[model samples]
Structure formats: C-alpha cells, structure tokens
Target: MRDYVQTAEEAARRAGHVLRAWSSKFTVREKSRSNLVTEADEAAQAAIHDFIHGRYPHHGFCGEEGLSVAGNDSTYRWVIDPLDGTTNYVHGFPYYSVSIGLECRGEMIVGAIFDPIHDEMFLAVRGEGATLNRRPLRCSAINQLDQALVIASLPVNTDRHDEAVRRFLSVLPVAQAVQRTGSAALNLANIAAGRVDGFWSTSLKPWDMAAGILLVEEAGGRISKIDGSAFQLEVPNLLASNGLALHEQLVAALV
Candidate 1:
C-alpha cells in the first residue's frame, strides 16, 4: 500500500507539472455540451501512463483521456484523471488537479490528488488516514446541516437537471451556503481537509471521484449514494459529508 501510495503521488505530481506548464497555452475542445477537454489533459495523461506503466508493468490503468492499459495483473488497477476540472483549467481557474486512485481486488487502497497551482497534495491509504502536504487531515466536526458549508455539481446534458436543481434548492435554505466548484475531486479533497463540510454530485465519472472518495473516507468522512445506498465506483451520484450528526440531515434533504 505504501508503494502504491508513493507511485500514485509521484504520478500525480509529474502530471501536475505537465498541466501547469500547459496552462498558459492549450487548445480546448468540447467533450460534451458544456464539458471541455484540452491538449494538456491528453499530454498529462500520457505522461502519467508512461510513468505508472514503467513502474508496474503488470498493473492495469483506466485514464480519463482514453488511455486504458490492461496488464497481466487483474487484481490491481490505477484510475487516473490526469487533469480534472478541465473546464477550469482551460479558463485558468486554478481549481483543477491531477487525481489518481489505486484499487486492489475492487477495493480502493491508495489515492492522491495534486493541486498544481497551489502545490497541495492530498493523499491517503485505506486504514492509514489521510493527509494534505504531509499534514494529517480530518473532516469538520460540524454536526448541523444549517451551519454546514456544502458543495454540489449538476450533471452535464442530463434529463435529471431539474431534479438536481430542486435538490440544490432543498439544501440552500437550510445550509449555511452552497457552491459549485467545477471540480468534484477538489470538492471531496476540501471535505477531507475540513475546508468544506459536505459535497454531493450526480453524473460523475470514476476518475472524477475515485481518489477523492478515499481521501474523504480516510479523513473520517461518510459517503453514500444520494438515495442512501452504498457508494460504488461505477455509481455516478453520491453524497459525502463529515461523519457527524449532519450526514443524515444531508441525506434527508438531498433525497
């Protein structure tokens, strides 16, 4: 697990450097109606793929940039989002990051998320706790939904947009405040670091929340589907919060 963590951190950092270098000059294309992808995303994923595959040739890889490498080992897989928040990155928002999560036998074992612009690295290993820049991290202790700061993201080009909007409306009057940061990965990292009290999102890909989910879990947070089901990597909608009294409140409001 330590080796996996180290390798993931290194890969995330190297990919961060690539993203930072291309931040000033990169071409963007629409991946969907409003979602964007840039040249930096592809390049960074390539760098990460090369680095990780070089280190562990027998491990599989699933990257956002369509870089999938199937190796001899079927039990270990690296999930990569070389440049999460591509929209923010293209617009120079500085809120994007490089996210990597390693799963062994279908269980997330290690995770790393690097915010290049701020040089913040959030990492975790299952059962070993989480960290931000080598400092221990824990979720906020806020136990009331009315006083909790929360974040959420709406699905792109989905018929459920109306339902999502209603859910946000449901949370708005009760929570201290609500925001959409354009990066689910960063939002989860923030929740893990105690910077945000809660986060919920729908229509997310595996790469978007894989690393951040582990960060939250190891930081003493709770995660589940919007309907209160167990969260699986393949499930798109999720609600994560500090594992305090407010979790049930959040689920109640969102559901």
Candidate 2:
C-alpha cells in the first residue's frame, strides 16, 4: 500500500514535470468533435504506465489514454488520467493535472492528483483522510446555497444538457458564484481544500471522479447523486458539497 501510493505520486509528479516542459511545445489533435488529445497527454500517460508496470508487472491498468488490461487479476487496478485538462493545456491554460487512483476489488482505496503548474498535490487514502502537499484539508462551512460557491462540469450537447442546464439555472440564482474549472479531479480537490463549496456534474468517467470523490468525503464533505442518493460508479451524475444545512435542498433542486 505504501509503495503503491509512493509510486503513483512519483509518477504523477514526474508527469507534471513533463507537462511543464511540453506546455510550450504542445501539438494538439482532435479526438472527437469537441474533445481533444495531445502529445503531452500521451507522454505523461506512458510515463505513468511504465512506472507502475515496472513495479507491479501483473497489476491491471486502466487509463484515459486507453491503455488498460481487460481482466482484473491482482484484485487491484490503477485508474489514471495523465492530463486531466488537455483542452486547457493546449490553450495555455494553467489548470491541468495528473490524476491517479487505486481501486482494489472495485473500491477506491487511494488517490493522488498533481498539478505541475502550481506544485500542489492532493492525496487521499481511504480511512486516512485527505491532504494537499501533506497538509490536512477539509471542506468549507458555507451551509446555505445563497452563500456558497458552486461548480459544474458542463456537458456540451446531449439530452441531459437541458435538464442539467435547468438545474444550473435554478442554482445560479442561489449561489454566490459559479465557475467551470474544466478538470474534475481539481474540482473535487478544490472542494476538499475548501476552495469551493460544492460541485456537481452529469457525465464523467470512473477515472475522472474516483480518487477525488474519496478526497471530498475524507475532507468532511457529503456526496450523492444530484437527486440525493448514494454514489455509485455507474452513476456519473453527482452533487458533492461541504456538509451543510441546505444539502437536502440543493440535492432536491438538482436530482
């Protein structure tokens, strides 16, 4: 366990360094209509995979770059996103990160997110709470919606967008401010560090939110479906908040 976290963090930090070096020389390509992938993302992911494979040769790997083993053999799997904000990185935006999380038997036990630009590391181990660069972090105290700063991972175009937009519009009048940070890992990290009061999104992959979700919970926040139900891997829609008095109301509005 100790070794896993160490290797993952080391790999993430190394990826961060690579990111900083490549930020100035990035070559971008479109993976889909509005989605993108970059050479930097590939390089960072390769570094992480190589580091983990060198140590744990048989462990399974699943990552954003599509380098994954089909079957789970060692009861542990690494979920990774070498560059969580490729769009921002291509545009020279500074808010990107390397996110790595460990899942044992389908349960997330450890997570680490590194932002090379800022040198901030968010780490979480199940049952051990969470931290940013080794300093313990926690959620905010803003209990009411009117005083809270909320965030969302906006979906571009889907049937769900209308419903999500409605929820966002409803909450906009109540929240002090709303911002989209582009990275789910950092969004959750911000919640854990009390930089934001709450976050919700309708669509995300397992690698995107797995580690960050644990960090939020360990930091004293409450997370559930936009409808106030418990979280599940299959249900990407979520509402995570600093444990507060108006949680139920917020969930009701979104869910």
- TM-score of each model, paired residue for residue: 0.97, 0.95
User: Which runs of model 2 end up more than 4 angstroms from their true locations?
Assistant: 158-161
**lDDT of each candidate versus the true structure:** 0.91, 0.85
- Measured by TM-score, how close is model 2 to the native structure? 0.95
Q: Tens digit of lDDT per residue, candidate 1, span 132-241?
A: 99999999999999899999888776464488888988999999999988898999999999999999987789999999999999999999998778998988888999
Where is model 1 more than 4 Å wrong at Cα?
158-161
Considering every candidate listed, which one attains the maximal TM-score?
Answer: 1
Clashing pairs in 1: none
lDDT (10s digit) by residue, model 2, range 1-255 = 778788878989988988888888888888776688988999999998888888888788889888877543669888889999888888888898899998898888898999888899999888889999999999998878888888878775545458777777888887888788889899999999999999999888877888788889889988888888888865778888887875786886675
